[model samples]
Target: MNLEISIIVPDRIFLRDNAHTIILPTLTGQMGVLTNHIPLLTGLDTGLILVRKSVSSDWIGVVVTGGFALVNDNKITILVNEAELGSEINAEEAEMAFLAAKSALENASDEKRKIEINSQFKKARARLVCFNSIV
Candidate 1:
């Protein structure tokens, strides 16, 4: 059985296709979805969304930041604030961004500022991870 998955960002749709399985990084933890899986709705974490179109197909990695996921029947929809395919990320830029975020995090004094910096750090890290996995 094939499951349909769609990933939407603010400006564009990252992916829309049929897949054999999907692994989502939720706020609570990772969740795996497949055809015939029970319905679900959950908040996403800042990380990767892995999709497999077939048993023999390679996984497609998408880096996302803050999203919501809904699953009903065999269809899955992900609405994220930001989304980028693995191939779209530049490793060098991601590394530089990661370093910047790290420095900002270290310099943040207030709790709120620290939280914001941490979020940026997470996003940069996710981008680097996706880029590395593609290589």
Candidate 2:
């Protein structure tokens, strides 16, 4: 049976795929879903959301910083603060951003700005990790 799932972000819609199962990175831990999964809504974390298609054993990885996921009626929808695919990441650019964020945390003047940069660094790192998984 086909399962429908959609992942939407602020700037764009990342995905809408029919699959067999999905795994989400939640605030507390990861979640796995299959056909006929009970409805759920919860806050997310910065990490990978793994997708498995019944067609094969291959897994697709998606990264999101924050947001919520909903599942009902054999459908899944993820509205995320930010999301990116594994293949889209530029490792060098992500590393650069990470370093810049680290510097901001040290030399920056504004506490909130520093925290925001640090959070971006974490998200970028998570993307890098997700990218590695796809390769």
Candidate 3:
């Protein structure tokens, strides 16, 4: 049996497909889901979501910025604020953005500034990680 997974953002449905397994970045930590897995509902974190279409296939990566994931039956539904496919991201651009975010985070002086910069850093890092995973 395959897991039916859907990645959705406010603007659109990023992806809908069947997968052998998936790894989600949750508030607590990374969580792995497989077919016939028990029902679950968790808060998503800004990170990479890895999907394996089949046992012998390479993993597909998607960068998601915070939301929630619901698992029921053999279906997984992820609703995030924003999402980008690894293949759609420009490697050079992603790398540059990640570096810029990292630098900004390091220089953030105020608590509020640090928190905002940290979110950017995490999103940028997620994009870079997803891009690298698919390359």
Q: Choose the strongest candidate by TM-score.
A: 3
User: Where in model 3 is the C-alpha error above 4 Å?
Assistant: none
Q: Per-residue alpha-carbon lDDT of model 3 for 20-121, expressed as tens digits?
A: 999999999999999999999999999999999999999989989999999999999999999888889999999999999999999989999999999999
Candidate 3 lDDT for residue 56: 99
Q: Candidate 2 at 88: error in angstroms? A: 1.3
- Quality of model 2 by C-alpha lDDT: 0.83
**List of clashing residue pairs for candidate 3:** none
Reference-based lDDT, residue 65, model 3? 92
lDDT (C-alpha, whole model) for all candidates = 0.91, 0.83, 0.94
Question: Which lDDT tens digits does candidate 2 get at residues 28-75?
Answer: 998888998888888888878988888577888888888898888988
Worst 10 residues of 2 by lDDT: 94-103
lDDT of 2 at 115: 76
* Count of residue pairs whose backbone atoms collide, per candidate: 0, 0, 0
- Candidate with the greatest lDDT versus the true structure: 3
lDDT (tens digit, per residue) of candidate 1 on 54-92: 999888889999989999989999999988898888888
Off by over 4 Å in 2: 99-114
| TM-score ranking, high to low | 3, 1, 2
